[model samples]
Target chain A: MKQSLFEIVSNIQIAENVFKMVLSGDTEAVKKPGQFVNIKIEDGGLFLRRPISVCDCENAGGSGKGTLTIIYKVVGKGTEKMSRMKSGTLDILSGLGNGYDTSLSGEKPLLIGGGVGVPPLYMLAKKLISEGKKVSVILGFNKKSEIFFEDEFKRLGASVKTVTVDGSYGLRGYVTDAMPKDAEGKDGYTYFYTCGPEPMLKAVYKASKTAGQFSFEERMGCGFGACMGCSCRTITGSKRICKEGPVMEKEEILWED
Target chain B: MGRLSVDLCGIELENPIIPASGTFGYGYEFAELYDINILGTFSFKGTTKEERFGNPTPRIAECTAGMINAVGLQNPGVEKVISEELPKLSRCFNKKVMANVSGFSVDDYAYTCERLDSCDQIGWFEVNVSCPNVHGGGMSFGTDPNAAADVTKAVKRVTKKPVIMKLSPNVTDIVSIAKACEDSGADGISLINTLLGMRIDLRTKKPVIANKMGGFSGRAIFPVALRMVYQVSDAVKIPVIGMGGVSSAEDVIEMMLAGASAVEIGAANLVEPYICRDIIEKLPEIMDKYKIDTLKGIIGGAK
Candidate 1:
């Protein structure tokens, strides 16, 4: 809801074509895990602001300034330009979209993410673990070289598992292949939360046995609710992915065939 | 400083800047950002006789200086708009709001407009003729002068408010359509709704937008919109509301010089949420820079 100039504290390539950036600014607007920030690229040709999720945020003491961490993959001209930026300020619109509802996550929670989607879940895992909840995380990537944030997730004291498609890394196949089972040898997760590309999201959605929340990605116009550009049909009705959610409950999601 | 007030079809406005429909979203969303009462008036999202889910996902494609959207007029139907949406809007906005209506047939337009006419807060009816006519072999109503006139005449009969025909830029003869609307009883005109455009993804080897084609608008389309506004304003005696790629206060003055009595900021609102407020604040300074005594003096000044 607030737009301010955020100074890039550091920007580094964490993995192949993937970057982790730390921004110093007024991070008060970012309230929850799945909410995103819209970065306006100063490049002459690029007019639309790029939306990236908040990986983590902390109020750096009582200086009234906080630091925001975001992870992005160099997908196109905007991200490519973002990758080249070394230092200086970025005009960022912070605190966008409805984040995940942690109240729904019961005693034992399962968190799933793929590739760049892993960033948002990092904050969610950290929050849930701090709440005295047993948290398990499954990180999905294409290969060993593309993997990121496993050690970071582990540092939060959550049981972390890494899955790769080519068998070049941890468990072979997708994140769905590495799901944990309960004491009865059934789907053990009390509740699940996920963020990733559509194919992987669908895979996790099909594999999950408990009530969960899914974070969706869409090509958005206004990273808020004004433009109905990013609306999707749910079981209840159509909702704006940028506003009503980047997160929706499992029962309401009506996946398009 | 000179006067900023404008009279559109006998209705007075505090200023000449109005947020275009689909971008403003009933005024409450932006009202959360800043006081929307500062605006002259805003056009709400396009409403239809029946509820429309709009097009499929991937409805937006970013361009060089603009973007293309195939949102397809997604709305909760006119009844829901009047019952649910307008009540919410009334709490935030005190000014009379423009109601933008779209439909598949003439009766559909009339039915929706007639319903909206009963709403106390509605100041004007912007009939979007860009919708494809269901009865006319799927041709867009705005592309044909006869159909555009027919829609204008039909909506005018049912509404007490001024009927401003919102025209599409996809047509070949823009002036003829504008003139036809004026002749058929359109009280005013708002020109250059998004231009028809598309973008393809090289990696996916398919159209970026699921609808394949969408209406394009942004700062990139400013010159084209100015030219169309100039042409249409000359052809009709009714007031012309120009929109397309208008972002700054300078662009507002330029649109007025090109013959628009007022201008709507469309895509720019998406880029910066507080853009309209920023532009309105910068206008007096820009007016001083250009040595313009009054905003109304510059309407059609270029012509």
Candidate 2:
């Protein structure tokens, strides 16, 4: 992990209570698509750094200075403080968590995301499409106005499906309701990858036919794995979410009720 | 020894900045970011006789100027720690590490401590009698002077190395417990572990931490920690390794003035991964600003 001061290029509201922040910094350490950056908001009496997964990144290799794109929901004080920032350096620990493994993406891979979880999958879609693999994305939100990055994903040469529970746009109900299945009633994608609330993940886990990867979220202290504050039980016993994951292979996941 | 050096028990630390256990993991986690050999010595995660999964998710809660953690002492157990973690840590860290042990019973403490005593890399055994997150043991022993003494004596019997009893701040009388450990053959004392604290999510109408309450730590608790260190160190003959919200080089000097021989940076390290290194690097400049020549000279100097 590398700690650097990222200059905010732009901070704009992309959706209600949601933001798309573009930052320029030393992005040399950010290695993969699903990896995250922990930003220290030095205001509002916040103590711990807020961990936000990478939505997309550019020029992030070998001493390359790059720009980072992150989508965040203003649920609490930290993000609220983050949403108000116009311009200045924000201290951040980047290239954290075990990001998605593109090598595991088979020919036809499906991406499932819900709400804020939609961000990380943007870069994943870009990666898989660039790899020349057929990519299908399912973006879930509460309603139409809450939807984000749909056109962005569509422009990435992937088949995009926007699912909203209110049926205000695209398919109705959850992402699982739109899981493309073959005549054999098996999920059509060769493999699947997902990020979202746990409930949606559980539904996707049951609906998925092929093996996939799941990204997890937990309240973290040190987002780089030093503190065991974000531990969760897995098939391999206990693993720190910040270190071992924010992403885990479907086979290793042991979901907690 | 250089200006930053201080004697922790009989072991000489190049600096007094020991990363408190739990926050530093097994050392290599942070060592991956920077050279950890710059630290005097870091206390590894709180180990137990058996592997612990700890509390369920939402184990961390954010508070003003600090955070509450209910990690519940999750570790790979002592055997695996000796077999697995220490080996990984040995690769990155060259200093003699401090092993922090916690348990549900006196025998459990001795068993884990004795098991780890054979490891050469461990310079001291920090018996953690004060973990607020666990039940049946942990802070239960720490609240009572006699129970704390029993665990201290039990671990002291098994380990030949310096036994520093890590005290909890949740107690009504911190000095009595520190003195009890000293009387029971504790070579040193480390305080104040996280104070018991809780936070509630207004939206959910529930506790922020799934465990309901956890150890509150960070800059918000520095004054409470300093006061406790003053009281405990003044009461005990053994050296006090003070911690709890210690973040910067200036905080380190203040802790020493309040009767701490060395300082451990806790929640601050969570915010800044290189905080200990930063503090160790800034100590001399801050010391020079205060016209101090050696850090050891400031221990208990305030009185």
Which candidate gets the maximum DockQ versus the true structure? 1
What are the lDDT scores of the predictions, listed in order? 0.90, 0.92
- lDDT (tens digit, per residue) of candidate 2 on B72-111: 9999899999999999999998889999999999999999
For model 1, residues A85-188, the per-residue Cα lDDT tens digits are 99999999999999988999988899999999999998899889989998989999999999999999999999999999999999999998898644124447
TM-score on alpha carbons, each prediction: 0.97, 0.98
Q: Candidate 2's residue-wise lDDT over A50-133, tens digit each?
A: 999999999865585899999999999889989999999999999999999999888889999999999999999998999999
Chain A TM-scores of each predicted structure, in the order given, are: 0.96, 0.97
> Per-residue lDDT for B90 in model 2?
90
Q: Which ranges in model 2 have alpha carbons more than 4 Å from their true place? A: A183-187
Give the per-prediction TM-score of chain B.
Answer: 0.97, 0.99
Cα deviation in Å at residue A189, candidate 2? 1.3
